[model samples]
Target: MKKVPFIAVEGPIGVGKSSLAREIANYYQYRLLNEIVEENPFLGNFYKDIDGWSFQTEMFFLCNRYKQLEDIEKYHLNKNEPVVADYHIFKNQIFAERTLQSKQYEKYKQIYYILTANMPEPNLIIYLKAGLNTLLERISLRGRDIEKNIDPAYLLQLTKDYEQFMGKFINDHPNVPVLTFECDHIDFIKNKADLEAIFSKIDDQLFINN
Candidate 1:
């Protein structure tokens, strides 16, 4: 198989997207780009009151991700190396739609579209989905203080929103493959079999499509 230049793994919080991205980046020696979750000042407050802090949190992520991608394009493109990232730029719109009110969402969408218009798209996007129970357990195990107050209902809504977002994303960009993995039963972190299975599927998808 011809080497893939870039891959992005995406999922709702606690779905293990970063962990899988790490495994893939390590295996392929690709540059790993994990999203910055703790750096946002509004994140903890957003968890407490989403509506109040959503815009600030979203804008922080938008600006940071834009800068990060710009730097990656410059440095990695020059070196001709591959990149494996935990989050895709599209998440900006997804989370914005969920967190922002109608007026805020419209404004946010305008800014988002502008920022991402010229950004490089990932060759393949691996979206991992898991049941709410699985998400809750994983979130608990990770034990982020800000995440401690996260409501189960909110996570359930996020799961549905992500599914909706992925569906539209695939429909709009048919050329880029979006491999959906249902990860309720498997522990990709601990089980080598599960990790291998995910990578094998990624390999098959890329090879078949390419």
Candidate 2:
């Protein structure tokens, strides 16, 4: 039997990961797994004072994401159901490493590895990337009160971190395909052509190329 496709849409803040994930899930009629962002009690504080709240924020996200992925594996993936997630579990490490102190990061890394050791990996990763200016604009347009205090410097650095992590991910997970899109050039949300173009590429990777 052919394996069910599990696609993860990943990127830094304001990169439209959730939007694309939603579109993909709708198009394929697959299960949608969105990360619990607003529910993170530490998130608002983390955006204001990253150093002071980094550990708490990271831990909250890690635990919740682990539970989410666990449920998806049991109720969806194992049952031959396809799923499209807005964020990948590995992104937790990206933020933790960027904000946590060395000792805190070491501890967090240990927990992350243990929790994710047997988690299901995505068959395909749709990575969206854009300029720092574009990211800031999108974040402002969304007007999430919790994200109002986000630091541009931090967001810029997070983008760099994501790029580096994705580079390493490609090398480590050679069998898993990573489809990248430049969000600055393509407005998949508003333009039908752009949206269809992305869908075409996804179909090519998940079906034709698979």
Candidate 3:
């Protein structure tokens, strides 16, 4: 039997994960699953003082993402409907490990594993990445008020964390294909050629090669 495609776009902040995911969903007519970000009440405070609000912020995201995946599993994946998500649930661990202290992270890890044990993993992961300056510029252009107070240092470190995590992810999930794009050179939003290039690669990965 042919498997339904579940594609997740992942990256550090302002790396164009959501935008690319939306484009992919539109092109393929798949269900779009976007991660809730600005809706979190703790987000603003979390940016202002990451240390003070890390636990609350991370917990809220983890719970919400878990619920989102539950719905996807029941209503979409089980029904054999394809889906394209802006963020992968594993990203929670990336942010949590970066922000939370050792004890808090240990506890968070326990909850994370239990909640995600039965979750459906993406068949393909589209990893977007950019230089720190490019990331900062894109973030500023979007001008989300919640992200106004984000520290450059924090964003820089998050990029590194993503790189390391993705390396291990590829090793751990060899069956799941990952297609990475460096966004510093391509502007998918503004250039039709760039967008088409991405779409072509996605097709090759999910359809032709598969």
Decoy 1 TM-score against native: 0.95
Question: Model 3 over residues 144-198: C-alpha lDDT tens digits?
Answer: 9999999999999999999999999999999899999999999999999999999
The model with the greater lDDT, 1 or 2, is: 2
> What TM-score against the true fold does each predicted structure earn?
0.95, 0.98, 0.98
Q: Per-residue CA lDDT of candidate 1, range 58-175, in tens?
A: 9999999998888888889446778999999888887898899999899988888888888877888999999999999999998889898787898999999999989989999998
Q: Clashing residue pairs in candidate 3, if any?
A: none
List model 2 lDDT by residue over 1-210, tens digit each: 576899999999999998999999999999999999999999999988899999999999999999999999999999999999999999998999899999999999999999999999898999999999999999998889999999889999999999999999999999899999999999999999999999998998888434
Which residue pairs show collisions in model 2? none
Misplaced by over 4 Å in model 2 are: 208-210
Clashes of each: 0, 0, 0
Candidate 1 lDDT score at position 1: 47
Candidate 3: misplaced stretches above 4 Å? 208-210
Poorly placed runs, candidate 1 (over 4 Å): 1-4, 206-210
| Residues forming the 10-long window of minimal summed lDDT in candidate 3 | 201-210
Residue 174, candidate 1: alpha-carbon lDDT = 92
Number of colliding residue pairs in model 2: 0
